[model samples]
Target: MTPGTRKSALLAGTILSLSMLAGVASAETTVTMWTFLDPNKTSPREVALKQMIADFEAANPDIKVKVEPQDFAQMPTKFFLGHQTGGNPDIVWIDAKNLSGLDTSGAGANLDELLINQWPQEDKDDYYAKASFDAAMFGGVHTALPLFNGGSMIYYRKDLLKEAGIDPASLTTWDAILEAAKKLTKDNDNDGRVDVWGFGMPLAPLKTESSPVYISLLEQPAALYTGECEIKLSSDLGVKGITYTADLITKHKVTPQDALVINVDDVTDQFIAGRYAISIGSMLRYSVIKGKAAFGADNFDIIKWPSWTGEKPGATPLSGWWVAAWKNSPHLPEAGKFLNYMLGKEGVGLWTTVGGQVPTRKSVLESPDFAGPQYDWVRLMVDAWGQTGYMDPPSCNTRTLQGALNEATARVVLDNLDPVEALKEAEAKFADAQ
Candidate 1:
């Protein structure tokens, strides 16, 4: 079938499945769920989520579910507007990066009461403790429940690395990465043009603002709010991380000079098209590369981010979609019931499979079903996340602060400004945002 035809068929199938199971809503129970993921991606995790929802509907005939999907970039504004109009979803999927902002705004329901009263102790125990803890205590109140979790992993084209004579296994530090990048980078065609870039990473402030690069590197406990309204990105460690990223382009010349101009989609496209040997971002790139780019799993591989000596090995920032009820949601009890169903064993398994996302449930992570090529790296990623991960802190003005850091990093890398000076300027701007 043509690509368009296949896409249409997939959509039709999803709609049919949802319709078949959406039984009549009880007068008191209508659970509305809004998320930032597109439903048509056909990622394993997404497919499983659909199935889980259908199963939930089948079992709970009295509670109807309404799903509204939005793009990631548009979610923040929509969430705020929903808060203002008190028309938000009963369950909303939020990124960890936005937790601080949500906490400050008091837009979400505190899940503590629900957890204590509704969730089984075993079910609560099944979740990764840190994720569960983080979700439960935003500003000392349980604000959300972990849905899907993921962390960054280094993505490389093995064929390209072999041609460059670089041992992928030996890449354990930024210096080694730079050396490999140099070898992989070359004018493949003799037409006075470089055919492949050694590395490609998002650097545009506007684009990388939400990309999770800096958060991964700094390993700060929280970037925006310290729960008491203090900004922490102006620290020495933060400066070091920012400088290291800048050096990839300015000093090492490993990445594309115009990397700052590219967004996440552009970087992913270039990597899939074999325009770069290495790309750094979420491990879910495996699913995208496999399904969307039509590449086999064996064609690419992943590694943890290279380490910085004397300090703990840094991994990419950990973040994911979380389920939370809006403070004004009328269907609280049903929303709570749907949440329990979604996080249950079957739901967890289906969501992890279809979404191509890691399960937040420790039971699911350790289950025999999770053992496979597609999920092996998830284990490694989870281990690394536990060791080196940092969550965004609760801040009264998180988005603004994040924007400032993005601008500071961009100026240093793209505009060739001094790193220290740029960061100092960023710190000042961050302070002003308060």
Candidate 2:
């Protein structure tokens, strides 16, 4: 079965099982949660989260929080299936891109009334406007609360750029990046083969949905659809983005010719090993790789992705998970209390520091403690958030459309297919699928 189908089945089973357990919770109120992050990791977030849950349990002696870790890749399908089956968890993590799908599925509970009635105006104003707005409405109903806000940035090796004699400050456009890449690409072993690549990107089909290639190419002012039922990849901006990606491999030869097969982990590995000078990734990516990668923090620095038309460079798309309560959840009041606590000052601060994720709250962003060397990129990201776009297409059949897009990209870059013909065929397939 496809991954989506398998997730749907798992969620259906979970819902049925939970329904039977619901009746036995009279003595203790248990709030079930589904999340993508693995708590077993040695990251600060993992440690803090465990402590947070323990503290929550201590404070709310009558309630217990039971977490069910799920595969991130299957979260959307499982969430929809559980909602349809009346077995959704009290709280779950949801990707921003799936807002439209959740709204159409009628799976999420409207939280606007709760927010207005319960939260203070000061608390409401703390959140970033865009993050708050995206979570507030799904199919015209407020459904979820923003958790962590994130945006993409360019992570480059400073030493490598200096060695190439390229001024990092001047590398603000696609043309400049290509020129730097040429200078950076080198073979130190005196072999004919080039050992170092100019750039690294996550091109593996496994991570195609959240890959940087898509963000670099398709996410822009005119490329994304804000509605729940439109596809806008045929626009001039979209084409420009795609052509630029093709050019990186075919025209400029900066990125590896086989990049389409390299996953994010592999890309990170290469960057750490000094195989590439530059990479595109989310802000949290640096934190995640800090101790794990060979390169120390001093070796790399973050910047905005290069612009195309001489306009100021824009950051990549801003997106992250949100927390939502199921409409039928018995512990609605308790869940709301926990959510509020999570969004409060202490909770947001702990979560942000541990997870290396930007806070949704403006107050947290403005905190004196948060204004540190670690958050410089985050500030730049927020400043450029308006220029970024969410990564979802409006059509319900997005998976099929995405598959066609990936295939078209692979054909043009790897198979030597004509770009014009490949794009035309891909568009035709997308239109037919929709």
Candidate 3:
């Protein structure tokens, strides 16, 4: 070949090779995710999350996951504002209650097509119960996938129950629980004040931290909202439930009087200090209670929330964390791929193993790892799941509705106002917010 022709051919080959390298680089997509998971924390949840991201990137060499951990308290405001300005992340982990707020505003992507067209039927069937998945839908569109869930449980000192000659299982009804509490309350040192209360519950009018006891007592579905989608805080059942909760402090004198003003952390601190025989709150407290409570892990166990007569145990509603992709995410395909990866069996197992979360899939829940003596409480929680339900509140007014619920609870339980009157006032406030 002529020297000029050889040089031209070599130049064309180099140009083609460079063009191929550029195409390969452009094929790799970066999917940005925002979360409250702190990578710095060595907790199971945090470590597992970091590992999940690393594993996903390794498996999908063409996709990169950038997880930006944000301050937990500021996430809602940040996400909402980001959505408004088109600066939101491709994916986010949201609290279940908060999802409605983002979803109804059109910030969440409709995952129906993906669920139906992309996901295998076997994979879809792996969810613990269809309820968790069903709850993720809003307006018939799949808004998110269940990440983990927690419910209110009554953690008790097994030693205390034994000393009181009370079988924890027998306290399956509110009346029975109060009776047990009466027997369990004592002034051990003969001090004027009761040092050990039978039960501890948070009742402060801040956030919805104090709403669990009341919410636990109300009947399903109807307990959340009226048929018209208005707050049903003033309903007959609502009044009855809150009244019973107040009576536990005012009349029965079973729970600490200070419970009227305490929050979850305060009550939890006291619980770990061995100040109460029974405490009502989140299952997430299991880690601290088991790892740090003065009574030791062996002495601590949880009973399902008691139910009204004719109802099964754990009849209350359940709530938890969820994951979703943004509606306007630039990398929709990649976002969906990552979501499925994070929620798959290996991902769920890691979450349950490392984070101490209750598995949201039936197969995982029934797995031997989730059973046996070490997982006794998890087993009971599954039993409770059989009886509990989930009802999503209107997202637009979640903060307001939560505030209203707290205020009404304070008025009824702390101020000694009539339950019906307090709830009616809250219903009015809810209407105004709407």
TM-score of each: 0.83, 0.83, 0.85
TM-score of candidate 2 relative to the true fold: 0.83
Candidate 2 regions off by >4 Å?
A: 1-27, 209-220, 223-239, 387-403
Instruction: Report, for every candidate in turn, its global Cα lDDT versus the true structure.
Output: 0.70, 0.69, 0.76
Query: For model 1, how does the per-residue alpha-carbon lDDT over 215-297 read when each residue is reduced to its tens digit?
Result: 43365455434446565565666667777677777887777767777766777778777788888755655667766553455
Question: In model 3, which regions exceed 4 Å deviation?
Answer: 1-29, 114-116, 210-213, 393-403
Ranking by TM-score: 3, 2, 1
Per TM-score, the best of the predicted structures is 3
Tell how far residue 355 is off in model 3, in angstroms: 1.3
- lDDT for 278 in candidate 2 is 80
Q: Mind giving the per-residue lDDT tens digits that candidate 2 earns over 272-293? A: 7778888765565666666555
Give the per-residue lDDT of model 3 (tens digit) for 1-434.
99999999999999999999999877989999888887667756778888888889899989999889997567766787788899999998877567776665678888776543476787788776676776667778888888887766788999999998999879887788888888888898997778778888876655345354355535555555665657667666677677777788888888876876787778788988988888886786676566677878689888887766736774644667778888889999899888888887888888888777888877787787876687788878877777665545535455556556667767876678888888788788878866
What candidate 1 gets wrong by more than 4 Å, as runs, is 1-29, 38-41, 129-132, 209-243, 310-312, 400-403, 413-415
lDDT of 3: 0.76
